[model samples]
Target: MQRDYNLIDSNRQQQQSKRGEFLASAAAAIAAAAVAAAATAAVAAAAVAAAAAVAVAQQQQQQQQQQQQHQQQQHQQQQQQQHQQQQHQQQQQQQQQQQQQQQQQQQHQQQQQQHQQQQHQQQQQQQHQQQQQAAAAAATAATAAATPATAAAAAAATAAATAAAAAAAAPVNKASI
Candidate 1:
């Protein structure tokens, strides 16, 4: 009986030792799984942070592009305004030059008209003087050739012919006889 009790006690001690070894292996597996989960969470957080940084960089680039476009548009508008102003000024200057030329042309035409009038008046006065001298010579010739009563009639007839000749030869004027 003592031998059997000793064998049973030895078997019970071996089983308890096997159960303690299995429990220790299970605790190590749980600890390893918790470490893996922690590492995965850290990786996910890092990925989210990187994505946020990339988004911010893209937004900044878009804003810079927009600003540059706005500045270029403003510059173009200002240049167009300056160009329009220059064209307007050139047109005004051309108009002024044309007006001045027209005025000068009018003055030149007036001067030419005045010169022609002066020449015409001088020619008329010379013709009048020549007619007067010819009439006086005819009257003297008639007085030498005729008796006193006939000489007066001849002088009167010669004067009438001279007036008719002058009227036919000269241009009509406001002051002409």
Candidate 2:
């Protein structure tokens, strides 16, 4: 009877010990589940924050792009204006050069006309001198003819002097031309 009583007490203690271990395991499982739930909540909050930051950054980048585009357009407009001004200046310079060339041409033509007039005057003077020389020679021949003794000699001398004058005048006219 004593041994049966001891066995019964031992079995009761073993059952109590198993029940304590199971309760401890159940508490640990509950604690683990709570921690997992908190972790999942924190992860979701962080994801939301990151998404907000990305959206703000994208909006700022778009605004910067717009500003840059506006500035580029203004710069291009300025460049176009400068190009037009340069072209206008170039055109004006070309016009000035053309005017200078025309003036030079006109001056050259006037100089040529003046030179021609001077040449004509020279030719007229040379012709007048030749006519005077011829008239003087004729007068000398007439005087010699009245003397009768040297008439032939005077005529020959007058003819030689006239021929010499014509030859000299021919060379002078050719050199002028």
Candidate 3:
């Protein structure tokens, strides 16, 4: 009976040791699983952060591109406005030049008219002087004819009449008369 009791106790101890080993292994497995879960969560969080960073970078790039496009559009608009202003200034300059040319032409025409009027007045004055000279010559010829009875006087009268007839037949140039 003592030997059977001792064997029974020894078997109980062995069984208890196996149970303890199994519990220890189970706790180790649970700890390993917990560690794996934590690692997986960390990896997931890192991925989320990286994805957020990439999205932010892409948004920033898009905004920068939009701003650059806006700046380019503004530059193009300013260039067009400058070109239009240059064209307007050129047109104004052309108009002023044309007006100046027209004014010069009008002044030249007025000067020509003044010169022609001066020439006409000179011609009229010459014609009046020629008529007075012709009348004086006619009066002198009449007075000599009334007292002329001698042959020499008669010949002088004939020559005077011939000269007067020749003068009437000649074309009068008022400027040279």
Candidate 4:
């Protein structure tokens, strides 16, 4: 009975040691699970920060693009205004050229009218002088024709009167004989 009691006491001591080892293993597993949960939360926070950075960068790029578009629109409007001003200047030059041409035409017409009037006056003076010369020549020809006929008739009448006077003087001299 003493040997049997010694064997039972040894077995009981061995079982108590196994139970203490199992309790220590359970505690270690819970500690490892808590550490893993903390590491996962840290990784999720890092991912959220990266997404916010990307969104900010995209918004800045959009703002820059809008500013560039507005500047281009202003440049196009200035170019259009310059083109319109150039067209207006060209139209004004064309109008000035047309006015100059009209003035030249009017001057040429006035010169032509003045030349025609001068020629008409010269022709009138020439016709009046010719008429005066023709009248003077006609009067000179009539005077020359009348003078020669009157001188010849007066010579014939004087010769017949002298012949009658000679015949009467010869009869009166017969009484003296």
Candidate 5:
């Protein structure tokens, strides 16, 4: 009976040793699983931070492009306004030149008309002087032709019809006396 009790006690000690070895291996596997989980979490956090940085860079690039487009549009508007102003100034200058030319032409025509009138007046004065001289000559000729002769000698000639008239007059001979 004592030998059977000793054998039972040895079996119990062996079972306890096997249980301690299995518990120790289980604890080691649990620790390895915890370390792997921690590594994976760190990798996920780094990926999230990189994504945020990329988003910020894209937003900044978009803002710069919008500002450039606005500035270009403003510059184009200013150029257009300046071109319009230059065109207006050129038109005004052309109009002024045209007006000046018209005025000069009108003045030239007026001067020509005045010169023609003066020539006509001079011609009329010359004709009037010639007519006056001709009238004076005609008056002088009429005064000379109006002189009268005496008729008293004719009355005596009636009595000379008789034969006594031959002795009263001495006539000039055809030949020399």
Candidate 6:
């Protein structure tokens, strides 16, 4: 009876030792799995941060490009407006010059007309003076021819002198002569 009791006690001790070793191994495996999960989560977070930074950089680049395009468009519009204004000014200048030329031409024509009128008036005056001189000469010749032959020669001479004085007073124009 003493030997059987010793063998049973030894078997119980061996089973308890084996159970403790299995539990220790299970705890070690759980710890390793937890560490690996934490490492994977950290890597995922870093990747997300990198993607967000890339998206922000792209947006900034696009905004800058848009701003540059807008500025270029404004510059082009200003140039076009200035070009239009210059064209308008040039057209106005051309019109003004044309008007001035027309006015000058009109004035020149008026002056020419006035000169012609003055020449016509001078010609008429010269013709009138010639007619008066011719009439006076005719009157003097008639008196000399119609006088009586028996009359005194002095009386005839006096009549001729009076006629000459009348002709001298009536002075013919050089143009008519």
Clashes of each: 0, 0, 0, 0, 0, 0
* RMSD per model, one decimal: 4.0, 8.1, 5.3, 22.6, 20.4, 6.0
Per-residue lDDT of candidate 1, residues 6-80 (tens digit): 999998889889888888998899999999999999999999999999999999999999999999999999999
The parts of candidate 3 lying over 4 Å away from their true place are: 148-177
Computed on alpha carbons, the lDDT of every model, listed in order, comes to 0.85, 0.86, 0.83, 0.70, 0.67, 0.78
Ranking by TM-score: 3, 6, 1, 5, 4, 2
Candidate 1 regions off by >4 Å?
Answer: 1-25, 140-151, 154-171, 175-177
- Order the candidate numbers by lDDT, best to worst: 2, 1, 3, 6, 4, 5
TM match of model 4 to true structure: 0.55
Kindly give the stretch of ten consecutive residues in candidate 6 with the minimal lDDT sum.
168-177
Over 4 Å off in model 2, which ranges?
A: 1-56, 147-177
lDDT of 3 by residue, 1-177 (tens): 999999999999999999999999999999999999999999999999999999999999999999999999999999999999999999999999999999999999999999998888788667756765775676566656665456576556666765765575355544435
What's the distance in Å from true for residue 3, model 3? 3.0
Error of 5 at 165 (Å): 59
- Estimate, for each residue in 21-104, the C-alpha lDDT of model 5 and write its tens digit: 888888888888888888888888888898899999999999999999999999999999999999999999999999999999
Best by TM-score: 3
State residue 123's C-alpha deviation in candidate 2, in Å.
0.6
Best of the two (1, 4) by lDDT: 1
Clashing pairs in 1: none
RMSD of 4: 22.6
Clashes (candidate 4): 0
Better candidate by TM-score, 3 or 4: 3
Q: Cα lDDT for residue 117, model 4?
A: 68
Candidate 3, residue 84: how far the Cα is off, in Å = 1.1
Q: In model 5, which runs have C-alpha deviations exceeding 4 angstroms?
A: 1-35, 126-177
lDDT of 2 at 168: 64
Candidate with more favorable, higher TM-score: 2 or 4? 4
In model 2, state the lDDT of residue 104.
Answer: 100
